[model samples]
Target: MRRLAAGVLSLAVAGILLAGCSPAPASDDSPLSAASPAPSRSTVSAGDPDLPAMPPTPAPSAVVDDAAADDAGERLRALVGDAGRPAEVALLGDSFAAGEGAGSYQPVRGVADSLCHRSADALLADAAGTPPSPPGTAILHNLACSRARMSSVTAAQAVEGHGPEGVPAQLEQLAGIRPDLVLLSIGGNDLGFAGLLQACVVDTEPCGQDPALRETTRQQLLQLQAPLTDVYRTLGAATPAPVLVLPYPRLFDAGAEDCGRLSSTELAFGLEITDALNSTIERSVQAANLPNVRYVNALEDSFAGRGACSPDPLVNTARFGPLLNAATSVPASQEVLHPTQEGYRVLTRDLLRWLEENPM
Candidate 1:
């Protein structure tokens, strides 16, 4: 196992402190059934001999133009629906979907609020209550938890472990409900991103120069394809709804200089990892070949000028004291890598646009 840096450790401690101050549980009015019992699976090996060769990862670029954004908005406005007949939507995955960096997290009924960290500010939250146009509501069933891997979608497991002993599988939360759409943002934890970031951001050594870490990350990336393919296939078979798989956005601009705690070299290394993770997801979706399952490429275009190093960043990049002391304060270092409330808003915009253009 990799060693965590002092800064990262401190961030973890800070998160725990923040969790203690969270408010009481909210109403459990979501359109989901009782949780299903966890399922068993064979131990996943590092490399599966049956897997095929993956394509080369694409270079990071901003592909969405102003005309595209405007066209998407127009399409959304044109959606026809009966008044008060809301669309049933389900959300699943890890920190990104749960809104870790975005503040105002909503507490689960039976579980500790801090464990799942499903923020009211999450993109799905915005989409749930508010439809693309007026009089068209979106009722949501969110089962996203922080630190969730692909396995967490279908098996009971210990997640980020900040506030609860264990969490029920996300799929279990969707037992009897048939949603119109399911948005999933997952697979980063399987890559062991927390540990990788610790080494890159908090440690003294440049991540690019660390052969052992790089090799390990590469191996993990290779191992992820089979399991990810399996997950997509399972979700496709289980749900009649269209399952949209959202990939992680680029956190830094490779061509730009570092801004905040991350150095230029460190930013470049992080970008490489992000690309590899996204590539793996895309390849796995293709391998699944489910017509109902489609990959969302909104992040690349939506996050164009909003990396950690950008002049107007969607993701957080502030250092400790300044971040913690701000009027709209962010608590920890882990939070720094995640999308802010503004970032989530931008994500929601892109998602709605994509959904409008590619109607199911």
Candidate 2:
């Protein structure tokens, strides 16, 4: 393991803190099936995988671009939904919102240490827990699965590997809850991006040098745009509140030496595909223009421009330091391919800020 720099970044990244608040009962007390049983999953992971520390983020500042700032503010206003009184807020998608590692709750809080990664019930509980309002003021339903796909977002899509129901079934279940606001994050599984990224790590051939494989991946990524467009339309039309679609986070670490492991070709191809997918999503959201539909700039805030090759990759694979836990008390693995818990915390904080800045 390499020696990681010990600074505010390292401390924030490695040190895990439990909130001073006590754990709430794992059940929703809201009107929308506040007592619904948790979803059943045959196989489950123990707890969230510990993430590495990150450099401290600069304080939130104004977005310089006039148009970008306007757009962001507009989106935030829309998200708050009638002064934060949205009728129903349903969370939809894959593992990002499912709280997979955190185990099921009667009312569903988020996965431990998961920031944006939350179940609908958890988000609603958080919203409700905000004082003045009890949880469940708005219906919150989570329809995300661990390894869901773009097709999964479609009405009748099926799960190929495991699980009793498909994403559409879950969505239908959410529809039953009749939410007013829907937060969605999906498509990674469909593109098989994660698997391909792992392959890129070990491939002996220079990355992106594999034109044939590159083209195949590119087309698949492009294909994902269509499903995203369709799902947005479908979900937007179903519920009264506008739908908020979130983009995937970049899975590469930035400024780390191991990043050299990824050839320029691989990095280029990864960026190209991810960007294209995001572009399509933005356009589709605009074209649809549903009354309550909106786009949450997940990629733009945390991942835009900064990819695996940027100064900071939230999901990095590069070696900054020990790459593993320094403390013998608990062994930690620095897997740069996923958001470190710290990275996710940053995302969560930003996400909340984004919501504040662009409340619907």
Top candidate, metric lDDT: 1
Q: Report, for all candidates in order, the number of backbone clashes.
A: 0, 25
**Candidate 1 structure lDDT:** 0.62
Query: In candidate 2, which residue ranges exceed 4 Å CA deviation?
Result: 1-88, 99-140, 154-168, 253-256, 259-269, 301-336
> In terms of TM-score, how similar is model 2 to the real structure?
0.57
Say which candidate scores most in TM-score: 1
What lDDT does the true structure give each of the candidates? 0.62, 0.45
lDDT of 2 by residue, 1-360 (tens): 223333322332332111101111222210001112211111111111131212222333212233433243233335554455534555677655553323232222223432223332233333322223442243345666545555555554443223344324556666567554677766655555544544454456754455555545545544455566777788777777657787655444222224544565555444444544455566567767786778776433364334445565444433334233322211122133444433443444456566677656
Cα lDDT for residue 4, candidate 1: 35
